[model samples]
Target: MGMQPMEWTENALIKRSTDFGKLCALHERDPEAASAKLETMMQTVRTMLEHVGVADVNNVEQASIITEILTKKFRAMHDREPETTEETNLIRSFAQIHARVQQAHAALQRQNGDKDTSNKSPNAPHDNAVPPAA
Candidate 1:
């Protein structure tokens, strides 16, 4: 079977988080160039979402909040901001939520695997019966 809904959500979240980290790394390596690239990519993502007809204002709001928090953290880390206590705390909160979501996804995957294995026929081919790699 394909990935469950929760698995897909977790994987997407992880990928996005990694993408953000890569963006931050690029910024560290070259701030001016990275900022321009980040801005372009952000606009691209927004346009793509709009094209897909997912006109959810909540999603847009969430994206804006996340972007603000990310920008503040980046500025603070680079000493562009003298202090960023609130932004730092927001980042920490986001990290905690990310971890919890990941953990829940893992648990769901494990539960699904166990259920499938228990339902498998003994005569089924072992390789064919195994869950596909994530």
Candidate 2:
């Protein structure tokens, strides 16, 4: 047997992120679009998950965790939506932005992985990153 992979125990969603400004600004400015985006993302993820099993449950669960945090942030804004917290503005905004980033990241991964060749050395430089001078 070989060394297994390690699992993240914390919020892996935004842990590595240091930037999300433009989308977040748009989220704050045009909340309606953000709401629609959130709903669409949730539906997309939910639909994709319909065919997955326990082994693939991590994605949905991660989204849920992010939703909880976003809900709390929404509450912190003090504009509590009594009738429909589920449809709150901030929560929707956060979900919308997060979903967009996640989708883009996945697409980038697919694009990058498409170029990975078995003949390449494991220690070789990544195609996306600039290589150092010789």
Candidate 3:
């Protein structure tokens, strides 16, 4: 058999989820702060893209392109082998921010989904709901 995947402790996962929730709360309370953080990240990515050029860059095409680039750069810089304390902390912070932003986005998506679901007609049939098929 192949090796089993490593398991995370329940407490660890709960702590992480809680931290992500807190980040979501922060985003909700002051979206400007999140926007500033993202803008800073985008500025960093733009600087890197200028350095490397768009042709040389592999992954900078998505909405979260800046976050993706920063995460990649951060990992490449620090996660070679054993990590120093500073490197570990940097990675942790980077990961937390990323996770928090993603969680906030997920929360937004869920809210949007709920709104859409609530707005839909309960009696509508799937195929005949809208105008005739073209």
Candidate 4:
């Protein structure tokens, strides 16, 4: 028999609330604090997956991943009297990832002339975001 696949990512993120949707909601409610934490966790996952030669975040998935939690973090950065450089950079990286993913999808569509490439997109830079201590 083949080895069983390990699926620890979702479990690694387990919180008081085990529901993914509810956990996301809780994070969104405090993006200023939670976004950085979430981003760090996610980037680590991405790195580990890439190391194992299985990192594939397509355009649709990228779009879905940038949920209210991320946008609220972006907004929080902008709401400051003077947005910190670090905050601006983090939000801007998200925007750039979104744009590049969209562009890759469009290019792939044109190249294949209606043939689906599974809507795959270019990988975004795997830089980490560090939130300043409160």
Question: Which candidate gets the maximum TM-score versus the true structure?
Answer: 4
Query: Per-candidate TM vs. native?
Result: 0.34, 0.33, 0.36, 0.39
Over 4 Å off in model 2, which ranges?
1-12, 15-28, 47-52, 56-63, 83-134
Give the better candidate number (3 or 4) by lDDT: 4
Name the Cα RMSD for model 4: 11.7
What shift in Å separates residue 102 of candidate 1 from its native position after superposition? 24
lDDT for each candidate structure: 0.48, 0.47, 0.44, 0.45
Tens-place lDDT per residue, model 2, 1-134, is 35333233465445312112233345568977765765664554444333222343355455545445555544544455534564455456556645544444344434456475655444334564444459
Q: lDDT by residue for model 3 over 1-134, one digit each (tens)?
A: 35343223456444434444444355557866855654554444344333332232132223134444445654554448425664455456556655544434444434444466655544333453234359
List, in order, the clash count of every candidate structure.
0, 0, 0, 0
State the lDDT of candidate 1 residue by residue for 72-119, as single tens digits.
555555665334564455355445543433333334434455465655
TM-score, predicted candidate 1 vs. hidden true structure: 0.34
Ranking of all predicted structures according to lDDT, beginning with the best and ending with the worst? 1, 2, 4, 3
Q: State the TM-score for model 3.
A: 0.36
Ranking by TM-score: 4, 3, 1, 2
Give the least accurate 10-residue stretch of model 3, judged by summed lDDT. 54-63
Give the clashing pairs for model 1.
Answer: none
User: Which runs in model 4 stand beyond 4 Å of their true positions?
Assistant: 1-69, 76-82, 114-134
lDDT of 3: 0.44
Return the number of clashes found in candidate 3.
0
Report how far off residue 108 is in candidate 4 (Å): 2.8
